[model samples]
Target: MSEWTCAGPSTEPAYDPSDPQSGRALVNYHLRELGIGETHLVRAGEHGLRYCRTLVPEGIGVCRAYVLTEAAWPEGAELCVTVSWSPTAELCRNHTTGAIPTGAVEHWRQRIAATAQALRSVGFVVEPSHVRYSPVYHSDADLVVYRMPEGVPARRAPAAADWALTEPVPPNHQRRSWTYPERSPEDIVIQALRDAGLHAYHYEDPLPSGRVGARSITQTVWPPEADRCTWLTWWPHPTFVRDPGTGLLPDGAAQHWRDSLERIREVLTGAGLTLRTRARPWHPDTDEEVHYLAYRVPRG
Candidate 1:
């Protein structure tokens, strides 16, 4: 994914003292210039903020544009805009070149330039130096962080551990199933492991066909175990698959995964685990994105 940021001096507060509605008008004007139609006005606290987002379809790829007031900036310098694009799995799947989609960089460059110009037209002083473009990894991943309870020590080696985690292919049932199962496969796996009195984490292994499945699972058994913890990832393969005829996944698939993940996070935290790092890394095998939440486990 690529990200571009532009910031400049705010000519006027989002709220126009002379006419309260003028603030929305000004925001709409700039957003229209950027071809962003859907806007949400947030009037909370002391500031009036306008948020706009749009998807721009460019040569075999799609980018998202976001415009909003920089609330952290002082009243005089609060205007900012960002545009970003990370190719979706569908786009990558349909890509014919067998490489990263071409022309994405140039497309974003042009769009960034246009956005900066639009901000300038609105009386914000956007400078060339203020515009920046850079690569962003795992742009679609979610993150959760927490700290483990104090006074717990790392686990000690035993002749045989209670459970073993391995990166195994999605079972036949999961591979063929097209409907949302009664329970999340990952949650079921974790519960089974815990039921058997084991401490473990699991992730999906990247498949050779540029696809991924529920595969990676492991006991926290690595050596040199310290206060730090390994990263745990939940790749949403089942959620990404589209329904047979509709060309879309079930409604709320993404939200369902989010809620499941949050539940898992809560469970881990309740178990006295501390999160150290949350990251999204492109899968080494499939080149697809996955999110990882890392937590420190109290050793025995």
Candidate 2:
């Protein structure tokens, strides 16, 4: 996924001062009346078409023209436009013939297909309308409508579903099934990064026996957001033991870093391990008491 820049509209307050929905209706009107091709006004859920300048103003947001076949259109000619709050709210005009660089469309189309396939393989429905190709960007190519399985919310849909069909299912049904993580608030977080987007996989790590461990939480922050900013991999725990007076380690420590002194002891105690509590900082200079349990899982 390409970086989702705040593109398509101006951030400045609208001079016309029209309500968002009304503004959308007005834009659709001009597209139809002006033969600007058919247009759609979309928001969170509701969407409609307006067909005159009176209906929608000319200056809207970035609009993309689609080659509408009788089949493509449910009613008449159809054009899909993207409206947003950004720097260029004025509707995007139709691109010139060959305006899209040669192979650009194909490139995005291929990416869409590949992403769709990957999503499907993970037990998702990869539908036709999901793959969109109208507005092309130098960095990103298309918009993909990712859908979830029968019971999941649209917001929590898995990515690139088609990939599931190719891989063989694991013998362990528990591991094979998709179990939304319990600890984390969201099952997945997709954010547009520089060249590619960051997809954070938040799920419980499955144990070898296919059973989720009590401490089964796992988070995979992909493509390390940037070079300078190191990603913080953290885990949380309820409580820990630490001496308040001296914030330094007592020495003879293996994995007994100051940060883990209290929390590790707590976890160990919780797991029925006999250990002594000591006062220490996670690092040499820090003095904050450590409560959230964390460890760096080795990555390949």
Candidate 3:
């Protein structure tokens, strides 16, 4: 039930990425991978492993633990782990953030040491890897298949199907829940969310820091994505997308975000807030023309 999530590969020989699936089954796969059995976990070992109660476990960690994915493949995505240092408390002491003061520099050093020890305990070696940190959070970790060491053999591969036999599969259900501010667009937006089979819960972005032009507001977000929402924020005006001045989206992640955004868009336009766009700023760094969508809100 924690906000942290770490994703490891599905690793199910039957899992096909082209048609990805997540839910309780993946959770079982991970528990077996970790060699632990706990209906719900507070923490694992002294360090942590990922786990979470889920409509499906797409490798989202529960509490503050990491999810175990496909053993460790050599030079594979799984082997490349990213360690992030929490930002300084002075900057992140706001309620919107759970900075918890990542604790002094030594604390992070201990974190690295402890993490390395835990991994080694479980047969993972600390090969060379990159390190980076931001003002806060990995709220995200992508996993890949890892290669096992030469001298030691890897643990027996566990199958989700086998694990499910021991653990009863819950009756299938969907959490198409929705809650939103009583206002324009949201009312219309709810319909799209329900249609998409996604949930909508209210979220409060940290109040704007005292930086120039910082804007924050209570908003609603869907499915695991924390922070700003594109729909409500673009209310008064602002549409966004790749450059070249066209309604086009490249495949993969970009298209996915746009598709989600468009869901709310079609509903709003249907409700009569016509979308309008005039200008798009050049990329702040790359100078490419990426633009946000703009729209004209209805007159009261």
Clash counts per candidate, in order, are 12, 35, 22
Give me the displacement of residue 203 in model 2, in angstroms: 39
Give the range of the ten consecutive residues with the poorest summed lDDT in model 1.
138-147
Using TM-score as the measure, the top candidate is 1
Query: What ranges in model 2 sit over 4 Å off?
Result: 1-99, 130-132, 135-300
Candidate 3 local lDDT, 64-122, one digit each (tens)? 22222111122222222222223223433344544434443444444444434444555
Choose 2 or 3, whichever is better by TM-score: 3
Q: What TM-score would you give candidate 1 relative to the actual structure? A: 0.25
Predicted structure 1: lDDT: 0.35
Instruction: Give model 2's TM-score versus the native structure.
Output: 0.17
Tens digits of per-residue lDDT, candidate 2, 1-300, equal 222232223232232211324334433333244333233333232254322222222332222222211111111112212212111222222244424444444444554455445434534333443223333322222222222335643332235442222221121212333444312211111121111212222345421111111122111111111111112222222122233466444442223343334443344334322321112324423422222222221222
Model 3: ten consecutive residues of lowest lDDT: 209-218
Whole-model Cα lDDT of every candidate shown, in order:
0.35, 0.28, 0.31
TM-score of each: 0.25, 0.17, 0.24
RMSD to native, candidate 2: 21.3
